[model samples]
Target: MPTIIMTKWPVKLDGSVRSKAMAFLQKLSHDDTTPGLHVEPIGGSADDRVRTGRVDQFWRAVMFRLDGNNERHYVIHGVWPHDDAITVARSVSLTVNPINGLPQIEAASPSVASAGATAPAPSALSSESAPAAISPAGSEPAAPSTPAQPAPPSEASPAPAPSEPLLVRLGRTRTELTDRLGLSADIADHALSAPNQDAITELAARHEGWIGMALIGLAVGESIESIVESLELDQPHPSSGSQEADLLEALRRPAARAQFSFIEDQEELRQVIDHGDFGAWRVFLHPMQRRYVEKSYSGPFRLSGGAGTGKTVVLVHRARALARRNPQARIVLTTFTTNLAGALRDGLAQLDARVPQVTGLGDEGIYVAGVDALASAVIRAAGADVGDAVRAVLGEDRSQPNGRTTSAGWREVLDGASTSLPPEIAHESFLAAEYALVVLPNRVTSEAGYRRVRRPGRGLALDRAKRDAVWSLIAAYRAQNRVEGTLDFAEAAAVAAAWLETAGSLADHVLVDEGQDLSPAHWQLLRAVVGDGPDDLFIAEDSHQRIYGPRTVLSRYGIKVVGRSQRLTLNYRTTAQNLRYAMSILEGADYVDLEEQPESTGYRSARSGPAPTIVPADSLSAELDEVAKQVGNWVSAGTEPSSIAVLAGDRFHCERLARGLAERGVAAAHVEREQPPKDRVAVMTMHRAKGTEFAKVVLADTGATSAERDRLESLDGSARADTELRRRSLTYVAATRARDELAVIQREGRRA
Candidate 1:
């Protein structure tokens, strides 16, 4: 069997041509010299290295037969028409540079000279040289640089007229660039010898994180100091002793091979060639992301980063990697919400279609589901009814106002408890906080245990009498719930945890995503389902994006992640300006991970975009009017309304905005766990905005009024602090969802 490398050209070919190329490659992989393919060499090319093979009457594939030392491999460059294929084979040059020991491709045509001089040799500048001026098989080199000569006054700030149609030649020898900048020889050679600066510039622009390295400065016209700074940040103090070895290693790196791939598995090759998705998983991943997916862990591992940092990407790949490594391993991948779980499941199908589907938890190749859903399944599998718990906690009908239940609704339970307490006792908010943050998390089964525990972060000190009084109220509520056969979500998780302790582990590996938003009981349940061993558990979370559930400490739940953790810094989704605006919303708020580690202070994005628009109107109608106008303008400008999300502070506002938009003749649909129709505008609350993103976001009236703030301030100190923190976090999460543009619409003079 011979090694077959696939370049990006086939992916760009017409569908019929691509199919032909894939079929031809499949045959060539089994036998290098497959008969009837009519592989013929071009006579004019140096060394006759390039060859053309017949795909059919109309299509032809161009390939480079690399033969050196004992190694022989074939690189399929492209598929095109017969004439185009032959022309490409004749004009292209393929060679393995002895200095770097990596294969190089270039056009045989002369370099497009800048100013007066010709470009230098490959050995003169960088290790990786740019290919020649000959265009790709079916394409043509961009119309020559031809610096703008002059322009009429109608154009503002048009390109400056070149003094003599060209300035001093931009080209330099690899040796000259390397000696002057003190950079590695390979990098220098690549800058000086490459013929297509435009191609390199485009790559740099697309992958900003790799701008400083990869000889990006040469293409983007950056100074040496700036390139050095970027390289330093990418890999501070690169310490390889052998430049040639470093270049070889770099060639094999995941980041370097992101744009090209050599397929070894015939099945995987078929998937890519059939779908033309060459950049899918296994290729095109950032080096850091690949590390998170493949690194071996001694215990549980956690990958934390902000939204769009590829945390979920890592989780999906890790699960597939585990399943592939251990064919019989029972792997479970879960997230906090059902929406994200669905997205993960879809991603898995694309990543590795061969992964077998299990019936449910405890019976599978890989299980993908929401944590709550998994808990319910686990409880049912144990012959325990989870609905009984829910009915017991809420009424038999779960009759709560607005068809909802929340910790804030605990005021009703506090009312029952407050009757027995002194007049000086804090309001229902404080008691609710005491129950949720401290009492339930610690699982205090007795009055004595509750009284002995020190209340951390709780400002109101309680005497023995006060503590007993609070306990009596809690006991009463629990007794009613028990008699009613009801269990709240939190209690259901707790019950699941208790059952798991007695039932033993459910799977070999349990992966948790969006872990920061899970409740304490949820964590406890997760802890119980996986044994303490290598790869027992994996978590992907970001505290800053935590929008729901109580803040939990993993150590208390026996899920320690102190030593096994990685933080991803590069953000692939949100633009730099949008990220900064999102960060501003979280300003002054401190967030810590489950292990109590402060977040990375250096968190930043390299992708830059326009600053968010902040609109302030004097009245509610005025604000809505502005929002509608902006939304209409965006739609007129060719932005898909589905790609634009209009989020409000609460559900009521969301409904109001939707109605207003409809009245104005704009089609709007309320967004939920499931997505809205493609043609309709999406309207949702900030809380519902979790685990989602949009290309454009319109945050209409997110801030509360002075009266609302006053009411919040009236709550107990602990309740007020927690409420405010969660609110701020919600806004931050919403703001960060905008990838390209953000607009914050609010009533003028309203208190935030």
Candidate 2:
């Protein structure tokens, strides 16, 4: 049976007592018959501050373990007052046995034992220090009392042998250590499992001052064990065929798997860095970086801003992010026009190279295409029947006028709808059917009712109930023709939606740029394509530049405008004075508010710098000469000749302006219902300037009066509407063309 030991020592003793204790331990270790002793300091000064105050003062207690033949030693740990008298008394109670070489448990004094046997225990003693005693059997007498002297070297014991396994120590405090490192357990585990011994040593060294490192070393050992278990090996000496088979199996389980996993983790870390997680440490990033990350994770989002507000910049970032998130999937990027599409691709390429540190995005990553391109691709992919249907429809409508079709045309087509309708009527009916298919609620209906249903804003204006009935008939017609591969743009969207609804799947996400320019028909198509999935959808647009037309269906299409829905209001392209003058001309009474003008160096208008000159020319030739002289002054000032445009109020005026300017060596080309000019001064109608800008705009026919004015004013409903459209068109053109200067020359006799 193992024997037990107990000891007590004064905490306030001088350096002599410490020397005595050390000597006793040293003697015991050197003694042949004694086993090793382990001395562990239980709780020491917690920090440098505590250590300073307690350095001179002795500790109140010490616990030590000893081993001997058929005997074992265990220290009974205790806490007591720092008083010298009490500590001395407690130390006197300590005893040691020569035979077992262990400290015997201290016993109660005779007075206390007799008092306890005769009467109830005193409450004061019980509350202060509970009297503890040990069995008298096999116990040794106390050391003889003597004048205090330095402890003898013969009393000390040898140092204890190392016993605890490293792995066990690590397992005990894994959570505590990992928490301090600000790391997840999985990551910590991976780090600890580093294959190289040097790496393991360095990791262990990082925790040198920590008590937890003792356990961490063991964890490292466990990681090594796991790694070893994962490795596969074959028999040392196998037959020729067996050896060949083993070699083949080894090749199938190449070591690259571990290497690849590590590389992937490293790449994810790089992603975090590019996402501006490390921006706080850096000075700057390309403008697209912030826009990209914000729009990518901003959930289903919408953006609205003025022109030059970086809406397109944000769109490029979103496309890059989407491509990164779905590398293997085809990403479709669509814009309203071919020019815009080309510009977007160029912008994306520049962004990739400029911000190459951003992960998962490359030059070839995004597939930038236009809406027409996407539709054509989808139609072709649907099969030969769909292709033939599209071609036949296009061929039949060869003579159809360009631009948005009129409501009157829609009425006639709906009135004469049959299987053998004209190609133009068929095209109109197809769009109408598609709109009904997507926007109408699902239901059944009769043929008579279907014919009565007219498209929105068409037919004789009717009361609420009659209009509702028309809508119902439209819905019924749509329900009857819900066939796949039979939809035009609107119907295609509805069909895609139907596939999602019935077939139960959708693309990972959808992204739309320049969303504000999308028409009601285009929006219907987008809704059908997106369906009801959690796939991320990012939409960006500038409402002020909705130059496509004035119909908005964004809200009805399920995209929610969020955040401020505006960019920083400051304009970077134009001087504050120029912006103020431009806004004054363009804004009028509809202006809600204007951004405060920023201080700026005055803008230098191109040579012949005159505030817009409004000359009333007596003849077209006279006006052409004045315009040519102004153009000549700009050209002499180093402005490119192509930077100038001569805008007229009507197509006929544009033709005459072109011919007159040509006579003056201006080389003006009319931008009417014709292909764009290659290298000549643009003589465009004011309406055609809706999405264009020019450095110097000459309003040739601004002096319109009488019948010409009446004819021009009759095209739109209200005078205010026509004025606002023309003003916005001018603003768009002027703002875009003039990076540095703007000139607007009005033909004086062309009445406003």
Candidate 3:
């Protein structure tokens, strides 16, 4: 029996040494004529050099010994650089039959003149003339005439293999397993030794069919079987289906289902105000509502509805749905005003616990902000140079004349010339216009811009005033940027859209709240962000509640209306009588009954509140007193302090009402166009009260014969505005602030 010892390579060898070693082995193997003739490397050019004390350096070597008698055992050493003949030098000698005390020795043959000449063929060597056996210590052993016998074969089987291991076949021309796996050869070797066979199998299965042929040479039988199994040529893992089920189960938790339910409720006429998981309930939407939740798609989607419908609710729901569907995508939620933005944020938060994560349209993912805020964000992201220019031209303290002139200059440069302006120039011009409009008062810029110049004293010159207004706008922009370090919601959305277009595609869906309130600019910006995709655009709005300003035209934007408009007509918050009263005031002859169902505990109107009083006040102060008295009574009757809102037709009336209520020891807070501070009773103008609801409401100045009513009806050009504003106000005032009671207070001198 021969013993074979395996050791690591001692030193890295160059290409020449490796080639020579291979050639020598081939020569030795060709000369041997036995089935199991072992050919191994001995210390030579290919051998690893190792330190052998102070005497010399030894080479790590391999020795082969053959048992069959007819086979020739050749010990070849040394690898030549080229075809140079190796000088057979006596460097190390071997000893044979040491135990038998037989002395044997061999000497290296001198270099032959024909160095590159091929050695004599194996057929030239006779069995009896084979080389004598030499021992490790350089002794030649005496040869015996008898032949050696063969050993019995072994009976051990290979180890059990992995269940689904990857199999790779090496290419004929290449020794690498990479040709087998279709991977780069370098990766193939390490990949085969990957710690997790299942992961490798899964990875391979991703490439499936072609892998079988590609990996043909590298796999043993067991590994091949595993690969076959992975290809689904065999049964799949028994646990696969269960694992899928587990994933679904994780997604269906209460938190996940909340948004879906909220959306369903909104669609079903439940009229549930901003309740439930706003984020999760949106996820439960049917295909139509879900469409709006998409981040990107064709738009011009119009969400038109009457007052008290869940338009804003749907918008928040859509946003939630979008966030849920695309956890990684960014979503921007913006409204026209800071107040609306805050309401949206609060409403969305109330809808889902995760809404907090989705709120605040920061520069980061999925955010809620106002228009100005969004614009600011856009300016900042465009880079400091553009941002500074915008700030300079739009700064409020810069004076009106200069700002307007600057704005006109930039607008003229950008408007029709946008195609020609470089990105930097376009950005600067946009900033100028944006700042101009943002900072200028409504009187100067008009709520929406077409073109306008200011008169000196009366206003600044058209171009000069525009420039000055632009400067004023820039001031506000700077303040927002420096103070809060955030863009207003509108600015944020525009910036976010720009960011998405540049950074990557927008989210899979986008949900806009208060869709009716979105401006043309906002819609345009959102359209740009969504781009062209299969994604959906969902907008929820009540046209009747267009109290803040003009609503964006959905039809003009190319959004096709699908199915009939979804109407949430049921009035869940008010009593049938209250709904009737409110509707009559709003719709007059056109009002239709809402048919509210009775509550199980039996309906009660604000714990025995008064039957709306008609007072005869001599003056505004007298009217204020009457209104204050009514509010005090509601509080005494056990209504929550925050439940009551003083509804007025105008800001002046709201101020008077707030003062009167305050003087009566009622701690009330005015609901401005922006967010209100916490802990105060609300005194909101009719226009600002659209989506909000309260426990009890006092609709003051409702007397038909009052001067206010006459003024409301008398203005020919303002008729539509008054009607819309009044109807919205009546609906908002009656629907909200009436969880239990609604009070209509009109001076006695005024006729019905």
Candidate 4:
């Protein structure tokens, strides 16, 4: 069957024209010869290689038909009016750049000598000989007349000369761009021509391929190696097939996928039409992210990056990829919370609704749920076999242990434990960490096991006597929890892991998002659910976004990711201004990742915007009023109400902000676990907004953080440090969620 590579450039079209274009794509994908498509050759193009298909009476979709031995591939350039479509065809340049051997498709201004119009007649394979003038990178118009073809892309600017938005300060030589970095001569010259960093960013924004990614990555100080690994340009494809077939293969390259969407079948074409242009464009994956999604690891692989770095995006795509590759594989896609899992499920559906989804674990297809949900599923799957684990948490009765998630349960148990021991050994917080990090994860049921357990990442150490004391308290907590019918999420995971280890469950692959927040029991459960093997565990974590738990070492639970880790440093969700402010929140904190490696949260953003605004209002009440006005202004300026948010420190504060906005007649909804409705401004705590983002954020200080900080200050040693780390991370998480704008509301000297 013939393939269709839809150009994903920013095309603007009216509802009518867009509808017609969708119909044209559907018709073309099913049968190019369909009468209404009018897949006729365009005039003044060499060999009649470029053609125009009828989108409607006035608009036409221009494309290039590449013929293989037994197949044909049609690449739709854009939709334009007849006269404009003809000119646009003349402006189209599809070539495999000689430097990298990767296919390139772009549209130039009609005034510019388009390579397609001037090059040799035609080739069945690569458009390698075509050489369009390359200009310094810059942004371009979204579309033409009537939600039209993207305005002749700015990539078609004047030929590279002294370079605008120049990158002279970076001192990147042509050899580095070409031989070393794999950029085409034209693209290298374009980067060299730029006058400043913004030019590089502008060019990158317009190109949608290596040139844009490379320049922006370099502009933001990413190493050439880092950029190359993420782009996956280093992978060599030995060319043995017919030139035309090779061209098709080239589109499958990691680099080309960043720009083109190859429609697999009619259903995908339907999805393309339904998503329209921008929505489909949103699903494009960063090359490195795609790399993680597709690569097979010996055991567990970890992908780490700062907030908004697309870790979750990678996990979602990986789930689909793994499912497609292993049809019968039992794959579990999980995260720390049920809401995040729901978000992942929705994202997967949006990505490709065709991917199979199953409700329970071990069945074919994918099982999506929170980590605890996964644990519960494992427990439920091995119902009778899971009695031992149930007993571990529920004591003798082995009945359902249901109460608060053990946070309150731990306090209750601590309130009744012997108080004669040292504060560190007797504290509820200490016991919680010890149980989660050392005891629960290790399945330490007795004092001997607790004493022997290796607490690698724990900030404090316990002697034999201290261990005995802690074990006694843990015994009491479990006994009390069994009476109260209460079980912690971590305890459930521990029990589930133990059951899986003994019974050997059926999960083949597990993809975890927000891997850092998962407790020790969760890690052990994941390890057992999918015992270490080829492509077993794929975790996406950002320690800088570790808003909940302390640092975890995956090695302890046999979920090692030491040598199999990839770090993404580019922030895709925020502007440089917001990212900088977010990183500043973790200035002095050094984070050791799950592998015990010192991790840096330093990241560079592709886009630049206004520096984060600090709204140091006189008081919390005034702050709320100012925030309402700012959100009102943003909504008035055309930002979606849901895209505008006022993030507070807690639920109480979030509700207060929502009421404050409502009183001011700015519609706001306080969201907890559910998604914020599109018609209302999202008033949410910073914690609830962790996996989500906003276009404009008012990070209000209701003075909620001060009390926690004051309480943590009284904590000694590692407790104080861990609490402070999470506090900063929470603030960072909130600040970074702002894609374009961040306004901080502070009444005193503290971060909101």
Top TM-score hit: 4
> In candidate 2, what are the lDDT values of residues 296-357, reduced to their tens digit?
34445654444333445556656666666656543445576665565566555544433222
Tens digits of per-residue lDDT, candidate 3, 509-543, equal 45555555554446545555555444445555544
| lDDT for residue 339 in candidate 4, whole number 0-100 | 74
Query: Global lDDT of each model?
Result: 0.63, 0.38, 0.40, 0.71
Q: Write the per-residue lDDT of candidate 4 for residues 93-114, one digit (tens) a residue.
A: 6766555666776446424223
User: Which has the better TM-score: candidate 1, or candidate 3?
Assistant: 1
* Top-lDDT structure, candidate number: 4
Deviation from native of the Cα of residue 428 in model 1, angstroms: 5.8
lDDT of 1 by residue, 129-163 (tens): 11111111100111111111121132112244334
Off by over 4 Å in 4: 14-16, 46-48, 81-83, 106-166, 174-190, 193-196, 222-246, 277-283, 391-397, 401-406, 416-418, 422-425, 447-454, 461-472, 702-705, 749-752
Q: What ranges in model 1 sit over 4 Å off?
A: 1-203, 206-251, 264-266, 273-278, 384-409, 415-417, 420-433, 457-460
Residue 82, model 2: lDDT of 32
Stretches of candidate 3 exceeding 4 Å from the true structure: 1-304, 355-364, 384-508, 558-564, 588-618, 671-680, 703-737, 748-752
Candidates 1 and 2 compared: the better one by TM-score is 1
How many times do residue backbones clash in model 3? 98
